[model samples]
Target: MWISLVYLCLYWAFFLLLGLLLVVFLAYCAYVKYIHMKYDHIPGPPRDSFILGHSSFVVKASDNYKVMHDLFLRWAEEYGPVYRTNFLHHVLLTCTSPDSIKEYLMSPTCPKDPYAYNRLFYLFGKRFLGKGLLTNPDHNQWYKQRRIMDPAFSHKYLMEMIGVFNERAEQLMEQLAEKADGKQQVSLHAAINRVTLDVITKVAFGLELGLVEGNKTAFPNAISLVLKGMIDYMKNPFMEYMPKHWSFIRQVQESADLLRKTGRKCIMQRKQAMLNGEELPKDILTKILQCAEQENGLDDEIMLDNFITFFIAGQETTANQLSFTVMELTRQPEITRRLRAELDEVIGFKRDISFDDIANLTYMTQVLKESLRIYPPAPGTSRYIKDDDVIEGIRIPGGVSVNLNTYIMGRMDKFFPDPFKFDPERFHPSAPKPYYCYFPFALGPRSCLGQVFSQLEAKVVLGKLLQRFEFELVPGQSYEIMDTGTLRPRDGVVCTLRPRETASQ
Candidate 1:
């Protein structure tokens, strides 16, 4: 009799548990439906699934290896300037309006999207760029670090870097000279990447990486791997737990760890030097240490965070920009001729380009600006909306992710009449400057601190290239952009270089 009673009780308990799960599932469905209804007024592409939202569309496009910005461009054409996209429960508002761009990015109170920035804090379950200026979402904390590091990027300090920039660019030219035989195909992207890496390492940390001289360092490859891992982890959050992905995940983690480890070692050495009464150059490393000291103690991890941040941000975007500029120069001979003429006139045969020469390379400056318009390296940024806002007659609720994309705005027909044309004349001094539409380095107080630094570096490297070599693109190479964290030329900008007949003396 007792056994029968116990069996009956077990049967009732099992049904109750099942009933509770069903109720929870239904409640979740209701919540998703209600959330979707909130942004129903905002125009966007038709949803593929009620629960999944646009995630499947994104994943499918990613799987097909389609450039995401192309999709955004298409949608912008279809849905108008301010539209909404849903990723599961999260609502994203992609804004291309100049007015909205100014309000969202220029406001000091505007906060970075935690969901997006925090993900970058780790790459495949390993600490990467933790609470650094780039990934730090706290406005107050970011301001403190930015203030401490400001002197490192001041005009005086940047002027001091011009010599280092010229030295590195000269090294690159020497390396390219051996491979300048017209028959040999060279990857300008890869070569320029080495130069930028070497420049950042030497100028920022006072370390001579010698990447341009073909030093077999794992740092470059590690950075590439970490970027690839970032994309993978972002596209599929569960990738870290999947057994099939374990090998790549392990590699990404190790690469992240290696970078942090290197940063720790470098920081410790600098600290020791300070203790030994050795005077330190007021470079980025010294500035980083000062930031840590201001925080009441030397926080190696935080200092390392900025170290990795500088290493990646300082090198990658500038390298891609230079590479893209070379690719365009290869394609447009008229533009190339004009640029070479400007380089010849301003800096003819001058191997060491001075700051004054850089200032006077006006036409070269326009060309580089045009390149950034067409192919921005760090394409876009995101902000978290804390309060309700109205943009372009559409009401964006308080809790939304607003995407501000230079790539999208740069290509719009209304903004640029001939959007696809590689015309440097658009950026001529007499031409009207794009209002808020042309933010290759972003805008407002949170704008890129390295803007001047990057452009100066770009000018030095590119001016030397134009003065020394005539390069032709290898046939059948695609000019398509590849999004690997940063947008890069899909074909790696392969070219065959020949010494310019009127090469610099």
Candidate 2:
């Protein structure tokens, strides 16, 4: 009788637990239904599944290696400027309207979407870019750091960086000269990546990585792996838990740890140097340390956050932009000729490009602007809508992620006629400025702090390359863009470089 009673009790307990789970599932379903109803007014492509929503489309596209931005662009073209897409219960409202961009991104109140930015705080169960300026969802915390770090990118500070820029760029030119045989295929993207990594390490943290000199460091590969992990996590948040992906997840976590470890080591060295009465340059590291000191002893984790943040931000995007520019120059000989002429007239074979020379490279500036328009490395930004707002006659309900995409906007026919054309004339001085539509570095109070610094570095590197080498795209290479958290050329912009006739003149 006791054994029977025990069996009965176990059976009852199992059913009771099952009933509770059913109730919770129903509640979640109801919540999801309400969310769906809330966004019902917004038009998007037909949902592929009730549970998955547009995630199926994303997965399919990602599986085929399709550029996600291009997919978003297609949707924008089909569904008008203001439309919505669903990722499970999460509704993403994509706005390409210049007015909406001005209203939402410019406003100080609209904070970064916590769902999006918070995910970046970790990569596959490991800390990555935690509470950094880029990933910090809290506006007040971000502002404090931003305010303190502003001096690092000031005009005077940037001018001081020009010499470093030239020196590093010159190193790149020399490296390229060895490979400028016009037969040896070279990856400009890889070369530029090394130079940019070297520049940021030296200029920002006072560490000379000598990446351009073929110094073996895990940083480049580690950063790449971490970025890949970020994209993978975004595509499928549960990937880390999956048994099949454990290997990749392990590598990503190790990479994130490596980066943070490096940052910790660097910070400790700098702190020790300070204690030893050694003077440090007023670089980004100094500003970061000062910010930490001022914030009632902000922890080293936060400082490391900014350290890793600057490493990725200060290097990756700029290198991609330069690579894309070079790829375009190879395809458009006429445009390249015009750019080389501008370099000749302004710089005239001068090895060290002055800050004043950078200003006078108006044509080159236009070219760079055009490159950014076509291929912004960090394509878009997202904002969390706290209050309901009307955009383009459609009401955007609060508590959704609103995406403002430069890649989609810059390619739209309504924004730029002949949007696919590689014409620098669109950015010529006489041309009408593209109001809020041309924000490659974003816009408003929270815009990128490294915009000027990045452009300066690009000019020095690109100006020297154009002055010295005549590069041709290697045959049979696709010009497709790869979306690896950041957009870069899929083909790595391989080319054969020949010394310009007047290169030594």
Candidate 3:
């Protein structure tokens, strides 16, 4: 009788626990439904399934950045200027119109999404970006850190880094020349990556990556494997979440550890050199050390993170952007001709373009701007609101992620007269609307820190490349934009290069 009573109690307790869990889940679901019911009047994509929400539909079409942006475009057309989707009761609102995007970015009262960065942390944990300006919550700490780092990016200051760029650029040209020794369409993609990585290394720590010096190193292959790991993670959602468990991730992490360890040794060596009266100019590492001295010292952890972040970010964004832009120039001869004509007008054939001349080349600037607009390095930027707010008469709740689809707005007919067409003339100063529809580096407090640096590099490379090889998209090769990391080509930009001067024939 005693045993039977205890068994009954245990059975009832199990059912009771199950019942409570079901109730909580139902309550959560009901709350989500209530939010939808309350805001049902708001325009959004028709929810295919209330449980999964529009993410399912969005994920299905996210083959490319343009496709992901199309989801926003479709919703924008259906739902006024802004729309909302619930992610397990967490709201994600997509702002369709440029005005809405502008309003959100510009408003001082509004806040940047600290929560949205969790995804970034997921991509590259806190150990990589925990110390940098890019990952900082829009706050006073960011301001202080940015102030110290400002000198590093100042145009006057960065000019000293040009020797670094020139050396790497030479290596790149040499590599290409070697690859094209007899006749070969060298994987331009790999060639560009090598150049960019070389630049990042030498500029960041003054590390003479021996590739430039013709020294064979495992750094290239190791870095390639790391990049491949990242690409795989972004493609596979599970790896994105549980990064450490995946075997490839472990390999990449090991490589990253090696890089960080190498960076630390370099820093210490540089410090010793400085102490020994061997003064190096204010390269990035020098500036970072100066900041550390001012702070009395930097935590090694923070330093490592900054080193990794700067190296990865500085190289990845520009290289990807440059590669994609070059591909476009290859395809569009008319556009390419006009760009070259503009370059000729400014720099001429006999001379390498001066830095000052880079600013004056309006048409080339437009080409770059259009390239960024069409193939934004980051297709969309996400931020979660820290507090609930209202913009353009729409209410935004705290903890909701704002997916600002730069790619989508760049193609919005409401913003651009004909968003699909690529026309550099639209960027002219005399044009009726200059910034009315444009924001490539983004707007407001968290805009890209390397904007000027990137533009300078782009102009220099594009100016030089156009002056040499005339390129066109190789027949039967169509590269689709991969929406994953840095807007990469799904296959790769495969093109046949012919001399530009031979175009008249």
- Candidates ranked, most accurate by lDDT first: 2, 1, 3
Q: Give the alpha carbon lDDT tens digit for every residue of 27-121 in model 3.
A: 98899887777555556767877876765776676643434666676776677767887655656787765666776666644455665543344
Tens digits of per-residue lDDT, candidate 2, 41-67, equal 997998897767899888887774558
Q: Mark the regions of model 3 whose C-alpha exceeds 4 Å error after superposition.
A: 1-17, 34-39, 63-67, 107-109, 122-126, 178-183, 211-245, 271-277, 295-299, 349-352, 386-388, 397-399, 433-436, 499-505
Q: State model 2's lDDT.
A: 0.89
What TM-score goes with each of the models?
0.95, 0.96, 0.86
Task: Name the candidate that leads on lDDT.
Answer: 2
Candidate 2 pairs with clashing backbones: none
Per model, state how many residue pairs clash.
Answer: 0, 0, 1
Candidate 3 RMSD to the real structure: 3.6
Q: Write the per-residue lDDT of candidate 1 for residues 245-291, one digit (tens) a residue.
A: 99988988899988888888888899999889899976778766766
The model with the greater lDDT, 2 or 3, is 2
In model 2, where is the ten-residue run with the lowest total lDDT? 290-299
* Global Cα lDDT for candidate 1: 0.87
Per-residue error (Å), model 3, residue 307: 2.4
Model 1 CA deviation exceeding 4 Å by range: 1-17, 290-298, 502-505
The lowest-lDDT stretch of 10 consecutive residues in candidate 1 is 291-300
